[model samples]
Target: MVHSDEYKAKRLERKKRFMQQAKKNNVFKARRRNNFSKRPNFHNHQQENQQEQQFQKQDSTALRQRGFFQVLPTDDLPQVPQCSHGPCLLFEKKNGPEVEETFFACAIYRNQAEFCDFKLTFNKETGEIEVKEAVEGEEDAEKKKKKKKIFGYNRIPKALTEMSPTDTVLYCKTCINVFPNKHECVCEPVEREALERPTHLLPPVNEQHGESQFFFSTETLDVITKAVEKSKVDGILCIGAPRIFENIRALHPEKNVFLLDYDKRFAKFFPSKQYAQYSMLVDHFFDKIAEPKLMEFFDKSKSILMITDPPFGVFMEPLLKSIEKMKKRFVSTGKEETLFYSMIVLPIYIRKYVLHGNFWMSDYRVTYEGHKLYQHSEKTIVRLFTDLPVECIDLKNVAGYKFCEVCDRYVTERNVHCDRCQACTSVEQGKWNHCEKCDKCVKPRYVHCAQCARCHLYGRCIQKHDE
Candidate 1:
């Protein structure tokens, strides 16, 4: 037993030695494996390093291309696409040192014996027009001087001035009606009263009242001008003779203009049917205005360029049907007389619910000719007709112009009235130069309107503003 026990102890010691040697070898192999894996020459290690570097570079680039680094409060961001300035904020606000003259021109048909509705709203007892003292801002002081000349007011209207609080008889020109205040009488009733007057008592002729129609700001004018200039059409087809037509006419006088409305009085205003020919026809009615008259006048086949602000509800369907009929006529007549542009300023619901048709997009063509030689010719139209990245239509033929492989396409040049240049619009945005009213940077490349006190760069800048 003693001999056996000694042999077993010797064997056990050998076994322990073997296990220690094995453990040491295993540690050495593990170290070698780790070093080999981390070596830069290996594909896995090099790939991992390259991937990490690429991810880091990508992350840095993403951070660099952000707008408004700090998260603005929810309220600060403009919810609706309007003058970022909140409600009534733009209407009745005092101008600062940076803002120039707020000498805004407002037109009133004096014959209507109605008090100023807006004036009456503030002071319930008095319908008197408030006259405010002019501020000492550089822009305002100059504007105040202009106002004195045009409005004949010694000072700007900041508080009630024209009439006394107790005086109930407001002496407007022709249509006289006693009202608690100007705001008491609705706009429709006031307009009706003015219409009743054979002739307005205060006669402000076209020449004298040139600045009366200057209610549209220079910024609004810029947007309208851009929309008109960018528009690819032979001319504009104005449907309703609503108050908006006056503004449209003032905005785009260069294009061939046609107007159709049920109101004979509105059409009668354009004597000799000169600048804009108005068709006084009333047959079919849908909304408040005539629809068939507009559709019939829309027959000048080369695709009518329509832009109007129609009333909502009833007028929507008739207008859409008229548009659809017009579109069908173009499609069925074996001529692709596509509606070049239909820029309706009214609500989209009125367009869809009332018009009752899909607004299909037609291809637009944009092109440029030699500036000097083709200076007084109709602007070339480039047709973007493809669904891919960039597709457009080429204005190869209109009425009689035939395309020749050798000399390209040529047409007899019309008078200089139709000559147009391809123009682009850029809205302004910058630090320290934001419009106080709109709170947006005015587009660059536009000349600032000293009179209107905003930026404007279009021929239509000097159009009529009188309602």
Candidate 2:
């Protein structure tokens, strides 16, 4: 049978594309093989690699024997100043003690990029950190000039919004752009309803650098939204916490709710006026349209609430600093009388360090839907730390918690009021016992060591709780 001219031409076009792709693949394979062949003395290097592995094992063992650590865990760490990027963490040299023992560097230094230029030398004996100048050579300067990869952003056409609710649009995760159809995308594309519940179909948590995202479970989202409703704030600012923003927008579309998150996927899913591509660590906004939109949110609401569950392992200082910068920006928008409030979710164990400057720990434990550790209600270490009035945390609908009339706050049922402290002292696991020598409530496992002049389990870390 003879085909029509249009049908034959379509088949020919498909054949050309297939041939072009196959040719490109073959060229790539040949170049990869050519580069592999250029390696010097491959067989001789295998023997050297084997010896090097053996040496590394022995070296690691020796380092462990001497109590030298590569990374100083969070519990062992002390409160440090914040760099523009989240927090500064301490790292050990893993070398001889005669040399530098420890130093504080940017948390993002190794995890993502070397954008932060802050470094400090720690005096273990004196417990002080001094700024250390970074030495930049010519090679280092050249690397600095080479910027990281940046992708262009494109909005799904507003015309799609005028279509039926079931109408869908195409989005490409690889190109970080949206298109009307796969033929125009030039990248692998997924189709979803642009106006209706597109957030439900967002790509899984970003495994890439510069962000760590774990969304809130449905129950957790309910509790947060309820809290915002009771506050009756004019606006809600969700930093690195998109679920709250989405929930508030869905349930109360009239209320002014905005999201600032590092995940650019949100930029594609939500309208520019409602969401912004934000980085909490560097306090930067990648999208240009976000600045005016943020100011617009500020002006509409005299009272604004900021809810943040930043990336795991972030420090308290930088998080607070970034919020202040945002708060200042909001105040500059001519709403100074509108008090700014925030609820920062963090590990329960770190309450000791973060309970300053109007921040109070709430008994409402926050859990993630798919997180490995924080998914459980009982053992989850995550808790809400808020500057709002402690009396405002109503956990009547939640389980395993009781209200403390004396302190006017909610706490775990395991927490008992300490007559001496005159407050509910229990934080993480069990009821606390007041130590006569320490003159304060301490964990039941704590044993006061007079020589050390502190309450701690000897030969163990004090910061590590029942995990």
Q: When superposed on Cα atoms, how far off is each prediction in RMSD?
A: 27.4, 20.3
lDDT of 1: 0.34
Best by lDDT, which number? 2
Each prediction's TM-score versus the true structure? 0.27, 0.65
How many clashes in each candidate? 38, 0
Question: Clashing residue pairs in candidate 2, if any?
Answer: none
Candidate 2 per-residue lDDT over residues 1-467, each given as its tens digit: 99999999999999999999986764454343344364333357676466546645663324323333345544444677555554556667654434446777665543334455666778777878785555668457646545442322325535355445553445565655555544454554354433334445565564634455678888788888888888888799999887788778778987898888766766655677778877675466665667888898888888999999876667666566678888998888787734899888888767776788888888887898767778888868888988876656778878888888898877889999999889888876588888888889888888888666668854333232211
Model 1 spans > 4 angstroms off = 1-221, 241-244, 247-252, 271-301, 328-335, 348-467
Shift in Å, residue 283, candidate 2: 1.2
* Top TM-score prediction, candidate number: 2
lDDT tens string, model 1, 145-258? 345211111111112245455633332333222232454433122332333221232332222221121122233334344544555454565554233344555555555555
The 10-residue segment with the lowest total lDDT in model 2: 458-467
